[model samples]
Each structure stands twice: as C-alpha cells, then as structure tokens.
Target: MHQDTVEKIEHALEGWPLLDSLPRECYGFHYRALCVPIDDRYDIFSYENAVIHKSVTAYYHEETHEYKLRMQVGFVEFCRIEYITNSLEIFGEKLSKELMQLLEDMVTFNPKNISSLVIKKGICDWAFAKELPETLEGYQLFIKPQQPVKINNGSYIIIDYVDFTHASDVTIYYNMYRDEFFGEARIHSIPDVTYDFDSNELVELQEKLEKHLVPRMREARQAADAAAHEGEA
Candidate 1:
C-alpha cells in the first residue's frame, strides 16, 4: 500500500477506540498489483479478543482507480456480518459505529431479549442459529457444532461453550420417551449426569452449566480419584 493510502486509512479510523487499542502486531499491509501473487493484493487489519474477531481489508483496483474495503465482525467460528463498500470513509465510520453498538449490546444482553421459540429453534438447528444466544451467553457462540446425530431413539446436537477462560462443550438432546430436553457436559471419563429441562428452562440450563458445571466436574473427578486410590490400596 502506498503512503497516501495508509494515511487515508489512519485518518478514517481515527477515534475508533477498539481498533486503536489493538496491538500493532494485529495490523498488516500488503502491496502488489492485482495480477501479482494472490497473497499480496490487499491490506488487512485484524484483531481477536475473547468474545469476537474483527477484520478490515482494502483492495485497490488499478484499472478503475477504485478501492474496495471489506469489514467483518463476528464470534470466533460462528455468525458474522460482512460489509463491503467502495468508500474508505464509509468503511471506517460504519464499522466503528457498528462495533461500538455491538460492544454496548454485549454488556446489556439477556436471555429475556429472545423468544422461547427462537431459543428452541436455535438449539434444534444450531448449525444455522448460532447467534441467538449471544445475549444470554455474553459471547459469540461461533464454533460450529456437528449436525444432529441420531442415537438409539433420539437425536443430539453438540455446540461449543467458550469464554475468556474455559471451553466446555455441551450437548443438547431430545428424549423420545420422556419428551424432555436433556443437556450434559462432553467430558471424558466423567460419570454420566444429564440435566432435564423444558423449552422454558433452556436459558436456565445454560446458566447452570456456565456457573456450576466446571466445579461439579472437578468434584466428580476428585471422588473418582479417591475411589481409584482405595481400589489400589
């Protein structure tokens, strides 16, 4: 990228605190002709935090003297919004405004903001409705889960639960006989413990897992270890 273009981007991004606060290593620039190597065609700026990842890229078309700016924001491995514009000013201003709003929403999000139907549908079709619980979870649940897999008499969908400090995978399933929603931690070698919930208890189950699952798993593991030591003795 030319010095002039760099200056324009810096000016456009002025007053954007989120991007500005990112370390210098997160910023990258590539300069080459449109026909050159595929990797050197655009200048990219990217940043990733616990909850979201954001990126902005600029591609200049020499033939038309036009600049294409692409901005994207989303949770890691989940839902995202991509905005492309030819105006550098719009790219900077729009992305900054939208990001600020997103940050505000994150702080104020709650499960009550979403409908019960939406929650049920999101869990049933997690591959498609990954963003429905962002408010309740306070982070982007972008990690794609496998399609619902059939078991003996029911089906289950697994989705990722991630935060700044933990990654606890969860499986949501339906019991054909019981007609209930069941959730369990996807831990290895742990005793089987499944919580049954109704559609209304969906958010409550998530809250329980987020707050207590880890500690519960720890206690279970300790008990198992003690039992094993006794057997050895």
Candidate 2:
C-alpha cells in the first residue's frame, strides 16, 4: 500500500468520529471492525452480554486494487461499498460521500425498511432463470427468491439455486454500482467459487453451473457417501 493511499483514506474518513481515532494495520491497508456505541453520547454498557449495535470496516485489496467499505447496522444486515480506481483523489471523494450517507442512514436504521422497488428492479434485470427444471444434471434443483440483501448503499435482490442431491448451491445477484452480475457457488469438495459476469453474459451463469460446478459436486458427494458407508460396514 502506498503512503499516499493511506493518507487519502484517512483524509476521507476525517469527520467520522468512530473511525477517525482507530489505527490502520499493515498486511494490506485494513482497519479492524469499529463498533458503534449505543447512544449519541458514545456510551456502552459494561455488561458481558453487550450486543454490537453497529459496526464498520474498510480495507483495500491488493489483488483487485479495490477499496471495500462495509457497514453492519444490526444482526444480518449490512452494506458493502466498493471502489476500483487508481486515482487517490477520486477514491477519497467517493469514500467520503458513501461513508457520510451510510452514517446518516444508520442514525435511524430499520432492518425491515428495504425498498421493494429497488429489489424488483434488480430481480428483473439480473435473474437469469426464475424457474429451472426440478432436476438438472442428475441433481434435484431447488430455486427460490431470497430477501433483498443490502449492498452498495441499496438493496440487492438475490436468487438462490440449490442442488440438494449434491449439497451445492449457487446464489446470483446484480451489483448495480458495478453494472455486473455476481455468482457465488458452494461445492461439496472444492473451495467456493465466485465469478463476475458482464450484464450481457447472464446466461453463461447457468451454463457454467450445469457443465462444471454440478458435476464436480456430484462426484464429491457420491465419493463422500461411499466412504461413510464403507466405514459403517
């Protein structure tokens, strides 16, 4: 990480009282989670069961050369803001604006206050398949819509497809800020796979799963089942 990059990020975070005082760590421009105090006075209960009301983290990825800003308002609710830019000035400006908006939203945040219009538009645009055959590639496919998950300062509609027979699943969501479709898959044996597709390549998501991910998962699941039965015998 460059010194200028660090300084720029710190500058963007200037007015954020919660994050301003925290120190930055090395490994790859990162800040540990900053927990927000319970009230305007920044006071916290000293009990052992204190629940984290809100938290935020910001970091820069070396491989992607992108800055990621994440804020979690409550349990199971979060927003991710990302920026891929070489200009430190631009990064600072964008980060500052997003951080300010996120903090403002948190002042009166409600987990259930998601925008249905945003969700509907995202689904209409990104969903490659609303309904798939009950079975595909010898595995039972289960498909359904998920509650919108917050991302990039707005709600993102997600559709999930599960191969119950093979213990695998693929979740698809649209990144409005990036104008790209993102697919995340969990297979039985291999590490999780995440891919980003251009808006035009939406159909390729299904093709990739049917040709590659599903078969691999089937093979891994069958082998694991066989091993378990063998041990029982």
Candidate 3:
C-alpha cells in the first residue's frame, strides 16, 4: 500500500501486453467469480450497495474493454446464504497484470464492510493447434492441469493438483477445457477464498503468477502445439 510499492507495481506492469476483456481469439486466461456480501442492516436497494454495483459496470468499461456481465443480487434472510453475482470474464489477460487492480477496485467501490469474499469460480482458457491427446499421460503434460471432467470429446483436460495460495486464502482449480471446435486450450481455476484485499496480498498473488502460473502456461502451450503436430502426421 505504500506509494513506493504502488509505483513499483506500475513500473513492472509496463512490460505486460494489454489484456482484452473479450478477445476474439482467446488464448489462456483466468478470472474471478467474487461473492461479496453487504452488512446485515443494509437493504438490497441501499445507496451504498447500489453505487458499488454501478461502479462494477463502469470500471470494466473504463479500465478494460467492454464486455457483458451478469448481475444477480437479491434481498434474503440474514441467516441464509447471500449471493451478489459479480464475475469477470477474462479472455486473454495475464493474471499478474490484471488481477490485483481488479481486486483493489472491487474493494474501493464497495466501501461498506464486506462480510465475506468467496471465489465462486476461476476460469482460464488456452488454445492449441490440434486436439488434445486421448491418453492420460497427455493430460498429465498440461501446464498445471486440474482434475479431468468426464466428457467424450478432447475439448479439455484438468491439472493434476489444486494450487492453493495461502496469501489470498484461495484454493485454485486449474482445468484445461479444450475446445477442439475452436482449436483452443483453457485453464479454469475455481478458488475458494476469504476476501481480504491488501497490498501484501496483491504482491503475493503477483509473485505466484510470475513464478509458477505464467511459466506453466507457456510450457503447456508449447507442449500442446508439439503434440498436435505429431498427431497431424
């Protein structure tokens, strides 16, 4: 949160390719489905929550590219589970470059004390030249694939393990959803976390992406391309 740290982040971001919210050709990407709750006394139509909701729309347009969002928030009993549907669909954004600012903005707009922050789902997409392999070892070769979904087609594969980030307190599920029809490879991460956005956490997430996630994505892409070529022959 220090000015110096903020400045450092800004400088580091200069090298990153700008992420299009809705890229026509989506490569590999990940996004958050945030569950933010208002205080018990707050009404669904309260001015603060309304403004926060509005800001969510405005920020996506002003900061990033224009994309459609699904907004679902309703009045409910205090004891029941509350749903404030706010999710970002990231087409080709690098995690380290975009995620921190997105979280900061979410916290800033909704100034009211948030009761909880749960990552409902995290999605990542990676594209390849040919279809993914039918074998288990081929599935194992994916960058950081998650668990496999039972499906007939080669549209996807899941990473072997769930990546847990203690800093953000989110469990990340990295799955590769292969779209043979579109020739794309996707990594979908569903993280469960307690929402606490701070500068330290931001730095920690960035480090995780740069150190682990990004490299794996690159490697996955390369490996997928090679396998696809081999299949062609």
Name the 10 consecutive residues with the lowest summed lDDT in model 3: 73-82
Off by over 4 Å in 1: 1-120, 124-146, 157-172, 176-179, 184-191, 194-201
In model 2, the Cα lDDT at residue 96 comes to: 56
User: Tens-digit lDDT track for model 1 on 100-156?
Assistant: 444334334434433344345455444334443642332234333323322333433
The TM-scores, one per candidate, come to 0.30, 0.34, 0.20
Give the Cα RMSD of candidate 3. 21.5
What are the Cα lDDT values of the candidates? 0.41, 0.46, 0.26
Q: Measured by TM-score, how close is model 3 to the native structure? A: 0.20
Candidate scoring better on lDDT of 1 and 3 = 1
The local lDDT score (0 to 100) that residue 13 gets in candidate 2 is 47
Lowest-sum lDDT 10-residue window in model 2:
41-50
Top lDDT hit:
2
The TM-score measured for candidate 1 stands at 0.30
Candidate 3 C-alpha lDDT tens digits along 64-169: 2222222211110011011211222231143325434443433343323211111112212222212233223123222222222211222222222211111111
| TM-score, ranked from best to worst | 2, 1, 3
**Cα RMSD of predicted structure 2:** 11.6
Residue 179, candidate 3: alpha-carbon lDDT: 18
